[model samples]
Target: MALLARRAARRSAASTKAAAPPAAVAVELSIPAHFRCPISLDLMRDPVTAPTGITYDRESIEAWLDTGRAAVCPVTHAPLRHEDLVPNHAIRRVIQDWCVANRSRGVERIPTPKIPLTPVQASELLFDLAESRDTAAAIARVRALARDSERNRRCLVSVGAGRVLASALASLAADGETPAAALEDVLAALVCMTPLDDEAARILATPTSLGSLVAIAENGSLAGRLNAVLVIKEIVSCIQLTGNVVEELVDALAKVIKAPICPQATKAAMVATYHLASSSERAAAHAAGAGLVPVLVESLVGADKSAAEKALAVLDAVLASEEGRTSARAHALTVPVLVKKMFRVSDLATELAVSAMWRLGRGAKESEEGEATKCLVEALRVGAFQKLLLLLQVGCRDATKEKTTELLKMLNKHKGVGECVDAMDFRGINRLS
Candidate 1:
């Protein structure tokens, strides 16, 4: 009832101001000096009281600390640990009230900010999740808090929510009878707490946790599968993955691609696959053996520019291994797909596709001379030779330009017996680089 009365009074005040006398409206109103953050010189929405006894907008101060140049107070230059910054509720209310009073002057109301989660609150929420008590509500509450503000996310992370969630998932992996829907909810909340600390990464890197995530990536709902792939990507980035773990990651990615979820999931899997293949030769060979090259080859045919670029980059890295080359060489679509992707998607994609074609054209084994002849013949059949010449006639990156020239030379050297190295169609051409 008191809250209702306060809102009614706020409305009355605004109506009064909106109907004020002309002279009263003529007087220019200004924000109080104290209401402006010293760092931003702007009205403070989320005013936090720093240890220096000065208040600044939350985002401004957080940005100051993220610079990592110094941890000292931005105002006082005194040593400051940001964890002590408290929400200045009193100031926030005043600022909001003032905005309401001046609404006729185009003042916009700042909705009340959500109360940040105290460490105790965060711990209790994690406890509920960990203890399996009303688990869905707990996951929803945790996710709601995380989505509330950067401050809430920081508080959750500070209290070790990452490790707790990872441990919970690890337990799910160990105990098989649990419904996978719970895993989905827990993972849904867990995905937002990214850049997980070393301990959390280590925990999720365990075999059981990875196995559960792989299972989700392969068979869970699209949202759950995307979150799983994302978590797997983060874990791979954070820790030193073993051969078996790398293989598992590759297999998950391959499965996701084969199933064809949303673009986000495919891109995540591609990024992870690229990282795994580039990490080591053995991993690259494993990726090829898992049929990544053929899958990428098929996917690249009509892919959008970004996906094509990423797929080509992964294909390039995978082709560095003999296994990748052999696998791609064995594919009927490899040469044609490489040719189709050339000079079309992006500079990077064009460069990678050209490199992949060269690798396939010059197979590692002398006994594969027939493969090389077929590769060149297929390139001619698909007009790859013409595309290479045009790539030079137009412009490209310096390194890509070099690769294009090398490919042109190879084509020239292996031309049909009578074809005098066909001069580039430089009709309106200026000096070539």
Candidate 2:
């Protein structure tokens, strides 16, 4: 209310101000002592001529009208107003001269500053020594880079020469001669490993390398968990290597999911498991044996929105698998949660929820016994159809045209969709009853 009143007052005052004729030529005016307001310390807005043949600003005049004694200056607390500011022309000239002196464009405006070394560049220095022909020189450089913190130096060296060393060691493994430096090279790389997919897979394949990577993951480093995900994508069948890698991956993922620092890594692990299950029979059995699906379902119903999203994504991936479609037959309660989340989640999550629900609905339709079909239909009616048509008229303008069209068709085929569809017609508009 106060804000509205002030705006009204300003507009009223501005309308009454008289306009002056345009100047025939450009004329510069120096700031005058009488033109400045003592209260605001700014050029006065509506100056009035005084009886003493001098012009005084509004604030100075206001102070004099309030009291007959000396008025305090607004800018400086010194006592001086109408009486002290006696139309001084000399002070105005000094201010204009000072302004003119400060006006210029020159070399003093350069803004460049001294640059410092980046950690990446420092890491590069360590790797450069690996290419040197002299072994002693290269090892000396590695030692210097490692310094007192062997982990830090190893991290740099692993990222740099780590791959070349690992490949060389892999070649030596075929010949049955494991050099002492081979394990160290792989360990160094694993400890310093970035979140790259290829490096992670290589590190996990070696038993010694896997132990080192696991240590990093358990130490709250996240590198081990990251490596586990890398290996998951490449496992084709249930060989000796596949079983060991899967066990390690599951163990590493369980540890990661429990940590507060990288729940996303846990999500990644679940997603990789989902993807693997879809492609391999052995993987499906392994994942189910590890109790992955129930854990993922719990996360979907969990409190955290981010974790729920990841869980849902994993579920979505899992549903695409033959095992997932088969498992959905037994879990009747899952459909309701997926339906409820469609509207409750973020925009992307909403789309994912819709997609997952649609797939499950279609999959259930194919079943002869209509497994979970009634519950899914009820969830869609209460969860999606209740609010979805209304949303089509509000935001979400860019929803995929075909998807939206398909949903509309499905809604029309639904039992209670008549009420929602009637709400959009001309006569029924705004009259939901």
Candidate 3:
């Protein structure tokens, strides 16, 4: 009887014992497991659910879809399409609220993600642009969507919006001049939707393409001209423009450099010029004839570093041929300009500048007359000799060093050997000492 009474008393004492303090019991709250992306394993900012019931940050999933894997969900390997990745706004809201609640823990609130333009919507927009029924609204919508996100751009490109936009740019021929505002809108969207597909490249290769782009580059608004030049750079990269078309393209690019709307415009113009001149000697000749050299030289006066480099690159390509060299030699600023570009700009600028000068030397050397000696004297007169020596002093790549040495010897030959060497002040120049 005594043991049974003690056992009952112990059971009641254990049941009446106080629980742990709530202050100490409650620790930090963990984020919900479903709030994280499967691919990134991080909290989802823009949670989007795939067709297979897996959620990911929109950027992560879009990348998975774009890299030739659009047919399957990354997590489940189920069939999917680019059009079916639905945004989980409810989950996004929850994730954001969680972030807000944990503000003291360095957790930042995720921004509301942009709604991506679906491929279906992009297709409809393309149709609207093509039919010219809701042209203005369609153009504005396309521009907005293209500027929104890379995924939207991919969607636009997939539905052939790039080609249609290029067509809109060239439509001045068939439908008369479209409104300038409308054209500029189309240009902005086209600029955003780049790396045009093979079909778009073929469309840009047509004769009308060059004409339309040139008109815009020469006569459009500053923004329009900038966009036009950017598109021209892309278009010229793929197509083989020639004959009168090359001349026209050169003229437009030269005009841009001569009176640039912006540095971007000038640089893009230089890139387009390099593309045309670098491949074909005929194109180089055409560029020279269209008066591009002087324009590039003049643009270099107060230009920034990158612009200077591009200008020199264009000059190097243009001066590769005999006709281009002839035009440059006639220009008063050619040698002085080349000399000034040496060592003051980037290594690429120096290399391009030296290459152009060497081309002039070679061209002058191969002539029937004694122009090589005249060229050497003229280069010396422009102070190119010491720059070449300074080139050697600073140490250069093997090729540039070899050319500089040859040019030095040529200067020695023409200026009476001792006279050329006597001009050197070897204070800082150690390599030639």
Candidate 3: global Cα-lDDT? 0.77
lDDT of the structure predicted as candidate 2: 0.48
Q: 1-433 in candidate 1: lDDT tens per residue? A: 9999999999999999877763354244666899888987778888999877989988888888878858878878987766778999999999899888887776777888766678898988888888988767877888889988877888888888888888887887788877888888878878879877788889898888888888899889989999999888788777878758788889889888767788988888888888888889888898898888888987886688889988888898898788898888788778777887786677788888888888777676787777676677767666788999988888888877887787777776667721433444433212111
TM-score of each: 0.71, 0.46, 0.71
What digit string (tens of lDDT, one per residue) describes model 2 on residues 287-317? Answer: 5455555556556665366766766666665
Which candidate ranks first by TM-score, i.e. highest?
Answer: 1
Better-scoring candidate (TM-score), 2 or 3: 3
Q: Which stretches of candidate 2 lie over 4 Å from their true place?
A: 1-162, 165-191, 197-265, 274-290, 394-433
What C-alpha lDDT do the candidate models reach, one value each? 0.81, 0.48, 0.77
Best by lDDT: 1
The runs of at least 3 residues in candidate 3 whose Cα sits more than 4 Å from the true structure, single-residue gaps closed, are 1-44, 49-56, 60-86, 99-111, 279-286, 289-291, 298-305, 321-323, 330-351, 364-374, 378-412, 415-433
